[model samples]
Target: MIIQLLLIPALVLAVVSSLRSRTSLRGQARRKILAVLTVVAGVLAVMFPNTLQALADWTGVTRGTDLLLYALALVIIYLVGSTSVRFREQEARIVLLARQVALADAALRHVEAMQARSQQAADQAPVAAHRGVEGTAAAR
Candidate 1:
């Protein structure tokens, strides 16, 4: 009797989860489904004390305390995993930005070099013209 009752909720949850997974439920609907499942789990767990106690003993941990600890561990691991992924993505972006900056710097330097050469050629033209005029005047 107890075994059948215990399996009933689990079977229903498994079926519902599998069905929902196939059909894409997002936003509010997904949240509502999750909330309902959580409530069902709480109700079923309270209704069946022996199953919870058996699980606690088999795992060699306290009933409620160990469950809480495990839940906390899962939450922490999920948070850290998400944070690490974001950090990696940001790091990649930073590297790309640095490469762009380096390329821009190289281009700017090349432009400045070309400008300097152009200025030097312009500066010599007037002096060369003056020398040519003086030579022509001397010949006269």
Candidate 2:
């Protein structure tokens, strides 16, 4: 029906997007395989709705819809957990990077301040020597 038309494409898109986002080569391969299997299973389920009922009965579930709901719930929980972990890791990396940048800035400022003091001392040296020579001449 109209729902089938809407759901099939949505399901395929979800699988593809999830598969495209991965952290490692091994994970990417695993997800790609899972995505293919999911699409195949989805196609089969759409073609034959009774198979889902049969599967539910075999699994001791009262209804196929209920089984699907349970599976969807599990998937949602897993995605939430993984997303939380990824965010935590990214936050930690950001904090470490900020600390390194702050330290570098402080070091640069300290070096500049030391250089300024040295330059000021050098600038005053000639004036101090000229005054000393003038005082000696006056005394003579």
Q: Top TM-score: which candidate number?
A: 2
Report the Cα lDDT for candidate 2: 0.73
lDDT of each model, Cα atoms only?
0.64, 0.73
Error of 1 at 126 (Å): 0.8
For model 2, the stretches where C-alpha displacement exceeds 4 angstroms are 1-40
Per-residue alpha-carbon lDDT of candidate 1 for residues 57-110, written as tens digits (9 for 90 to 100):
665556755654554454355445545655776788899999999999999999
The C-alpha stretches of model 1 lying farther than 4 A from their native spots are: 1-61
Clashing pairs in 1: none
lDDT of 2 by residue, 1-140 (tens): 33345445656655554444346787668756866876887788778989988877876778888767755654565466556666876888899999999999999999999999999999999999999999999999
Question: Among all windows of ten consecutive residues in candidate 2, which has the lowest summed lDDT?
Answer: 13-22
Candidate 1: Cα lDDT at 90: 75
State in Å the error of residue 88, model 2.
0.9
Candidate 1's TM-score? 0.54
